[model samples]
Target: MMKNTRYITATVLDGNRLEIETPDLPIGQTIEVILVIPETLQASLTLSDRYAFLKLPIAERQKVLSMQAEAMIEHYENNTEWKDLMTGDIVEYSEP
Candidate 1:
């Protein structure tokens, strides 16, 4: 069976409950819920930080870039499937 998907942003309330208010949704219909947390809270660079980042020495900048690349690799390995550009298919990571 095909399903309709709707995206809604909700805040977690006390006791780990999410309060969602949407008039378009039916009162008694069952729906699947997928929670996507924002990444800005963890690793976002602000405008002022961007200026400071540009002023960093070459070695420091390379270190920062390497760290970010590792973080991206780790995040993708843990939470997502990789898309193979040559085959145009999604594949799970397997250790080489």
Candidate 2:
């Protein structure tokens, strides 16, 4: 897991007792949300099978994840300026 480079947050309230949430991370070519924990948590409010990630079909979940990622990528790419990875050219990333 990556630690604190950057992240996006989504807060969705699922009724009163449940809330849907995930950490949105930006990777090489896309942003990703980790819906599953690689290890167990150390609290009473542990995430389990009640989440949408596990409840929805994997394929449909992936589509939604992808949409979120694309929007996130577009957000930063549109909001910031970037220097060419190789060339010294400074370019403001504007969504076309």
Candidate 3:
């Protein structure tokens, strides 16, 4: 199971409860919340972090480019046409 961490600021409420307002996560998912002192907490990266690899240095960029090219070549070599599973055959699909 992959774990995700989110940093949020919540207001302390009466009766030992806290209220947090976040817009990213959808409703109905189980989440674990932990309390930490504001001064000691560091915020996690946002969705933009996924593309941070594009910011890599020149040598790293070359490595990434080479890997992408290799992957494209391998895909073209091993790819098969889409088929109809129930009919057990390759079927050309046309848009009406």
Q: Candidate 3 on 1-96: residue-level lDDT in tens?
A: 555656455677899788776778789867765344332332463557436656767765665566557655666668644323435667799999
Over the stretch 1-96, how does candidate 1's per-residue lDDT look in tens digits?
655655556787999898888788789978655344345663565788678778978866775676567657778888644545436667799999
Best by lDDT: 1
lDDT of 1: 0.67
Off by over 4 Å in 3: 37-96
Task: Give the candidate number with the greatest TM-score.
Answer: 1
Per-residue lDDT for 1-96 in model 2, tens only? 533423344454666343433445334445334542212332334467447456888876776666567765776688654534446767799899
Better of 1 and 2 by lDDT: 1
TM-score for predicted model 3 compared with the true structure: 0.32
Ranking by lDDT: 1, 3, 2
Worst 10 residues of 2 by lDDT: 35-44
Each prediction's number of clashing residue pairs: 0, 0, 0
Q: Is 1 or 3 the stronger prediction by lDDT?
A: 1
Residue 11 CA displacement from its true place in model 1, Å = 21
TM-score of each: 0.40, 0.32, 0.32
> How many backbone clashes are present in model 2?
0
